[model samples]
Target: MSPPDTDLLHSLSAELSERLKDLLDQALLGMIRPNSASQFAQHAPELENFREAITHSDAKDDMDFLRNFREFVPTTNYEPYRPYIAKFFATPCKESDVKNMFAPGLPYCLAVSSMTSGKSAKTFPTYRPAPHLLHHPLYLSFPHSEGSTLSPSSLGLWQVLTVECEDGQSSKVLPVCAVTVGFQRMQMNWEVEHDKDRIDLWVPGKTDPFAISLVKSYRAFFILNALFALSDRRVATIRFLFASVFVNFLQYVEEEWPLLVDCIEKGIIPDMENVDHVRESLEKHFTANPLRAAELREIGPPGIQGWAVRVWPDLKMFIGITGGSSAASVPKVTHVLGPSVTMQAPCYGSSECFIGLPYYNGDPNTDFKVLPVDGVIEFLDVHSDEPFERVLSAWELVGGGHYEPVLTTRSGLWRYRIGDVVTVKGFAPDDGLPVINYLHRRNGGLEMAFGVTACTESQLTNAIVSASKRSIGQIIDFTIVGDERDTPITYGYLVEIGGEVGEDAKMAIEQTFEDLMANNEFRVAFWQGRARKPTIRLVKKGTFTEYRRQKCDKTNISMGQVKVPIILSDSTSKEWFLQRVIMEL
Candidate 1:
């Protein structure tokens, strides 16, 4: 007999509550840990004030909470390093001087100047550089494509970091030294020009193969540049390398590791114009660096942990997303970067909203702390049948509940459903504000027989993670495809193994799946009277790379911007994966 509706809801609520309580306990433990607390105290020396600011009675509104949080925390706007940036600009330098300032073999030099008048004046200040002299500031660029989700806010943040200074400090010199990515060209329409200035760093046009190659080379270039900068001791200390997630960074490293190792062994920098030369040089380098040669040949683990430990030992922190696929890759990243590096989540944000909230360090359960100043955030109870009518404010959310984020942003996105489902881990100690973690995309799920059984991306991820841990061979990436054409619908998984997988590893993966389906009632129900077993396809190496390339070709998205879509929602994407399927279980 089917379970009663009320009973099902109660059971789900209880389960959610229990899970949340467990997460809250873990978060509390992390926060109050003797060593962690002591270290935070030592760094800030205002622990009590920070805690009190959040809990203060008058701190009832979002703006009030944001003001208190910003005052307590060291933000991107933190002024301690402002003077260092200012000092660099104060010294007069030419274009050549600016170019030569960067260490030899670095790919790009810093480009800095005060904002120009008119159009530039609106977004930036009107301070000019000395005549015939160029200033070197930290500038990084990315490929900008129309309709892409890359946030303009991130670029704006870079500008703020470089230009904004502490109150009452009257230095015309913008203290932070960094340039926002992308540039504007005259040929583009006025709207495009304004958008490019606000959003992009690189000038948009026909795709330059060389520029594409350079963009692909950025990860290696960044590491090499950091090492060179560290050697000179002129630039500020390399404290944190920030990105959306370490996984994306790891993928770039994995692709370029062999080439980079070749350069190091040959003691020569790679020439962008000559791919053949680079390959030949790498071949010669491998003869001498046999140890690295062997490591590279063995697809043991994801990431360049060994090289990072050896080269960037002083690198202290990695700030990025710790949710979704990024979280799955954390163990591998941790194993590679080692304990010296502190992995931190800077904040939660998206293309629509630039900054959301601060992430609680060491709390895997809590995704991010909401920024009261950013926008109005509402939650629709995900468990309720009519979730839209059951809207809850940030303060109104209870611990252990799941909800869909509905954001009304300052940037003109009104009541926009960000399509993210969040789980409330718990409330902050002082003001009782909810701490949430991104669970999965709202639409990230597969339905069988019109919702007779459904599996979400989160569930699939969990199962894959469990399977990987149980298997002897390391699986790098995977995607799920549902076949509804069959009488009993069958789900197929295309998995990429890090190295060659034998029968034992394959059996282990299959067995793990069997165990998971057996344990999950929803999965079991979905499969009941249909195919009892789902098929597993072990894809050959380089399959995902090819998939990404193809995706970029079809979508007009830059190769740099293409992400591995975990869910194949459409027939085209699904067929693409199906064609690449190598084996079936």
Candidate 2:
């Protein structure tokens, strides 16, 4: 029997794409208009006060408010550190010992030790005694994947806290120490009970008005339909909630350092009710600052970067994954946070093995120094014909080389390929450990005509980067999809332009891509043989946002975990992107 024609498959795909697009549009419209004004009336009082505070407060008033507000929020204490220290050091120290150890001040100890040793805690030769020992442990945790046995719950409430405590005496603690609360719950089922548990972990039990308000805002999301409304008020409320929670927590930590320690030591979990009382108190405070209403109106769209700046203006460092989709989002995030906040990637690891830590230098793209204590690290040259034979030790890695990480962990993962591909950034100065940066996933690329020619995620990213530089406006986020059903397989590029880019600029971008592919040997060869000329589709604003939201909804992945991959390898993701192409340029 003869096989079905390729044209038939392509036609069917086109029909399916159109149908999906229509459904998605209707769903998005429904999501935006979820609640009526009457439904939001209960939150009006709180919202009004929030608006007043933002509009009327002067620079001095704002600073004072932040100062006073931070006094009430609960922060991380020695309790969470006790378990972390015990796990990392394999020690059986008591809670009192942990407190005393950090008594002379945690930040001072870490600073002095790191400066003297010329190495981070992750690379310290051995655990030193007393004050010096504070700089020798990099608190690592697996928050993403479910394959690992370690649960965030095992460490208790503070395990889920994102706040970092600083001792007033020395003014030294890790500039950035945070628990992964948001993404940690990405693996959980999205039921009400699970959602409640996640919220409790995120905000913790705190009776302070701000804390209670923050917790209530999170609770509001439990009524998903009500919170998902597209109204400006809803968006503003969501932003305000995050801003209030974070800013309040920051101020609370800064002001009530001793009280925080007391709570931790006494194991006192606050009663997290009194939303009405909290609202009343906040309203009273804001009523004095009438100008804050205008300021509130001026607050930009809902995003973390802006909220972060307002809450913690003294932010010195930000630690997170800077590779893959995270890398793409860096431009948008940093732009929001401004230039002061230094970005740092803490380590390169997955559910399988806690790999290593990056250097503390100011460079955002600094490579991770492999942790020898964690497990055995190996690299296989993925481009090599015999990848197995090309296995190299951690010390044997060459600078600027690409290799897949193979970890042999103490947790029974023997020579397991974690599927992450990394580039050797360089070797550490003090230690010979190769400083590597994660590049992409091993199976994360597009293969045209059964590997006749394959376009890597890195390559596609490079093209987008090159195009953005040549284009009039910045390209915020982008995704590439391989359409195999077509007779000549084509790659569709869905590019989201950040600002206004006229038709002329868009054409210029297309021309730039054409010129780039023409100059490139591999892409040129691929197009000539199997694939057709790649098409660039400029999607409407919020296309990627909707894409991410929909994906999170379908997969139960949290917004934190919903990153736009440069290359969509999965059929579902590719189809979804293809359907959302608002315009072909």
CA RMSD of each candidate after superposition: 17.0, 24.7
Best by TM-score: 1
Best-fitting candidate, measured by lDDT? 1
The worst-scoring run of ten residues by lDDT in candidate 2 lies at 108-117
In the range 304-343, model 2's lDDT, one tens digit per residue, is: 4454345333444444565565444545555555566555
Cα error, residue 283 of model 2, in Å, equals: 12
lDDT of each: 0.43, 0.41
lDDT of 1 by residue, 120-185 (tens): 111111112222211211111332223111211111111212212234243222212122222211
Error of model 1, residue 83, in angstroms:
46
Off by over 4 Å in 2: 1-294, 298-312, 385-390, 484-487, 508-527
